[model samples]
Target chain A: MENRKIPDNKIKIPIIPVFDPIEELNMYTSLGSLHTFIKGSKIISPGIPFYSIIYLISGQLEASIVSRTGEEKYLFEICKNCIGVAINPNDDHEFQITAVKDCIVYFFTLDMMVEILSQDANLLKKFILNIVQKVHYFEHQARDLYQCRSSSRVFSFLYDLCLTKGKRVNDHYELAVENISQKMIAKITGTHPVTVCKLFTYLSREGIIKKNKKVIKIYDLNKLCNLIADEELTY
Target chain B: MENRKIPDNKIKIPIIPVFDPIEELNMYTSLGSLHTFIKGSKIISPGIPFYSIIYLISGQLEASIVSRTGEEKYLFEICKNCIGVAINPNDDHEFQITAVKDCIVYFFTLDMMVEILSQDANLLKKFILNIVQKVHYFEHQARDLYQCRSSSRVFSFLYDLCLTKGKRVNDHYELAVENISQKMIAKITGTHPVTVCKLFTYLSREGIIKKNKKVIKIYDLNKLCNLIADEELTY
Candidate 1:
């Protein structure tokens, strides 16, 4: 994998980046603090002040998002010599990195990485290439990988959402107030995300759910309960 | 959506790039040549010496990879003001972009874009951000979109590959000499890509297909033929 010929992203199916790991290793070690986490420990989770460049030094890690209801959806794995790319940890929901095995992690501040990158144009280019490769890899996952969840199961998933947690409008009846997302539902319910998109469209047509940039409003809690009980929803 | 303050990729997505389209339009018009293609025309395809930055000024385009056997798998769509990102188009296989509607395209050479970017670092930064968003989008597609094709269907897909095209040894039966990919098969057959991956493992264990970086050897022609005929071959 160590090709000195300026390893490019290959811009295609070889999802893994092919830059010189040795050079990357050198760069990571140049200026970063090392932190060790034991197995089954939270490495980086929600509400933690983690603002740095994350590079795995040893052992294994897994990253995922935990819904407000505490349902965890798998994201990706990190092992030795891998970059743990967190897009924005401070999202509305929760994101976590867990140690699957005893691990050593290297954390570099953004300024330090910028300093290093600014110093070496080639390295900056390489870094850009690797990030492109990674971003490309994850985007594919979002597009596909959705399972076709039965409509009832989807309704049930909607009903059971406990985190934002899932809220109740009156007399213990449920209504979602927060902007719950389609991808999360897809991951959690194993339903084709198209279904979630369709659900939104259907809601618009039926005027069942009203959602916007910041808020979501669900109508007819009894109707949602009825669908769950019937367990045979078509759309 | 025209949200400035330097539109970010949103770290997680809502994948369509959100940079100010007006500013982007100005940049494209500044350095690009306007080329118009009538509807149902091939905008960009394999075997064309297209080494330039591509921006869609207007109209619609579809990008896909055509297998050697003449089978086309849909990749993504490009509408107005979209960046048609081609990673490394000079792969061993074919990639094409076709105009679904009448299109006006802006073609910018790398030097021109670089020159413009060199003038303003903000534009350069914005460009990088947009690229990261795009690369991230495609990667998700590769990961999760594969449907599960049955073993028989998978085998049939393997058998029917006509492009590299699929070659028949001894003028009677076929074996893939070139490295046929699982993603292409998944896209073609709607088979879960994991099944394709499993097929590779099964082949290695049975010593049926031997593959390396440069060479792939397939043994036993009649066995493959019989399996396809019976249509109940279980892996």
Candidate 2:
């Protein structure tokens, strides 16, 4: 391989403000194309020669992978201005992406993406931040899903929510839970609704977590983390 | 937030050949400082207000995080020319990096690293590939670790190896396993070495995996994947 002659770019890297993927998409319009999908259409599936990255400009997408038993394992959702899928051609893992609502998407071939990103520092920074954030998210999900105990799994999920979404308030973490509920938590963790309620009480009585009208607070993160290893916790 | 003005660098993006991190590190010498740590010294520790990305230029380091019970969970090792730690200032998680051998390392404040990377498309691409590869590895690990059965955990480990290192033949995946052993498999999966050997025989008899003197072959990836959900397989 020939030596890569990199010229020194003396420009100061500016503080990146809020990200706007749509704005970035406009710059490379000549190199890529925009496509639309109606609701209930498959956007991406396994073994389809996928190597490009598609960014959602509008609507929503549900990305999943079929497990060995042929069950769809929900990976994530792609909302407006977010990445729909980024696949390396050499990777062995396969996933399916479907449109949950009518969507407008932009496709950038991997080569073109690399070209544009390598040329523009700000664009590369936004892309890196986006992927790094996803890495952080999957890390948290893996930790929670790896819990052996069922009830502890739910607690791990809450702990993840606190670490990712809750803010440190004085001595502990506090999160406004106005948008999340027990039923939603159950659906995610596969625990029964009754069991999720019981485990919440268990954590509340144990001083690990406190639940109020529209907020959930963590008094001891370490204690909640420890409960993730327990076989079971009785309320 | 204002719209970013991106210039047209008519220079075609060159094909990225083999990565040379040391070459990349040399270009950014002014942006970072190099330091040496003797064996047994801690490079990163929890609660030390860490926010930098260190590149290992020499020797080895072990990275770990203390679980809630104060036991160390081994994360990964840092060899030469690899990132020892990349901590974002806003992230709440903490980890400890320790020198297993006397090491020379380069420190780049997260800001400086980002600055340098954004300025060089080639450097940024390498960094993205590195992090994305880590994401792939951890996802494989999470899948294997999520398997509840002990024997199946070992199978999951093999399945991971197959997916990562094995090459596809006519219909099966074949891996040269001269380096891995039953003892290593048992240590990783927390199963007995005897159990590991027995499980190998069970999988072989079941027509899922075939182990030879220096190689392991998988006839059916789906069958092996399905076995990860099993309660147990007796040889």
Candidate 3:
């Protein structure tokens, strides 16, 4: 997982929180705080105050928030070209995050955000723009799980990950499997691990992709996208 | 639905894109362009550039993105208090959005956002924060769908909604269901609308709550929370 390089044909999904480095350098250079959480570390728990938004440069992380009744916990999935938000860093908020492997996240606090937004409505507007896109993304995921078949969902998800964070190599597409797991994918895709395992096995067998544990190397990007598109199969 | 007053309990559900009035005033005082769409209007289509983040103060909206392939479309359910990202405003990305009712949305262009973020890192940070919380909320939903029982998921969803967005009256918590439909509840809970109907009927018959179309009045908030907490027999 750690050695996997982003594959070729991997579409670039750039959230680009700060698309312009010069602007970023001017505003957040002083306000931001940099903190590093090594692998196997718990960054925040339910009892602690909410922390800042941490940007992941490299490594993996996992976090869960318990249900309101505190009876069960829910985990976060999806990474690379993604940003993690823990809003209410005060009491009565639900947030629990842990590093899966050695990961680096930049914590951007609320106070600094307020200060920036206070001066620039354009900044606030940009911030709102990102939120709007994210809501749309999740809503789409929810719809796919119900309306599409499991195989459709799987291929769609893979294609999406490639688009979001994939990099183009010589011919193959290498997905950044930073902290993603089969179990997490199963949960998100509404399939059992065994089912996902079987599906993965099929993809590998068809020479569409190869998996070295968590990292998947796509040998045939066209085939994968085609499967996601399901040109031959009618939904 | 227009007459529905904001309930105190319902306010507990933080609108991830909400801007504090004072803070907002400190930033943007002038209202930007107000884009209007008739009922059943298509706001966005695939391959369209994502140029703005839209905030809906009133009216209903829907958005969907094709999963890489052009064959399938994923629809987004939206209402007031929703802020959406036009992720690829400059690229030939295709995602379609429609208005369910005559709607008015506030649009902040991508150029403006980039300009702001470049000038201020805090602006970028705030945007990241908004995405983080949103991702967290959806992650929680995904987790519940996978791990929790059907009944638990329904009850807990209702309970959490109440905690975040419901209004507390003398003895009951009032839920204003302007934007939430049985279909939406089903989609989020991963249940059928018929089941949600049955669950609601069962709860109303038991005198735990009273449903007036979209308005749900809970007679005992504590008990409702307990129902979710203890995983009591909900149906």
Each prediction's TM-score against the native?
0.47, 0.66, 0.65
**lDDT at position A118, candidate 3:** 53
Question: Which tens-of-lDDT digit does each residue in A40-90 have in candidate 1?
Answer: 999677766455667788887777655434646555667677766554434
lDDT of 2 by residue, B1-235 (tens): 1232111111111111112243576667667888999999997776565656788888887766554445454455677787743454433355678997999988987557767876776676567666655554444444444435576777777887787789999989998878566765664454667888888888888888777879998999998888777765556
DockQ sort, best first = 3, 2, 1
Model 2, C-alpha of A75: deviation from truth (Å): 2.8
- CA lDDT of each prediction against the hidden true structure: 0.56, 0.65, 0.60
Off by over 4 Å in 2: A1-31, A90-92, A159-231, B1-31, B159-231
Better of 1 and 2 by DockQ: 2
CAPRI classification of candidate 3: acceptable
- Comparing 1 with 2 on lDDT, the higher-scoring candidate is 2
Chain A of candidate 1: what's the TM-score?
A: 0.54
Each candidate: fraction of true contacts kept? 0.28, 0.17, 0.18
* C-alpha RMSD for every candidate: 23.8, 9.4, 8.1
- Candidate 2 has a DockQ of 0.15
Candidate 3 lDDT at B148 equals 66
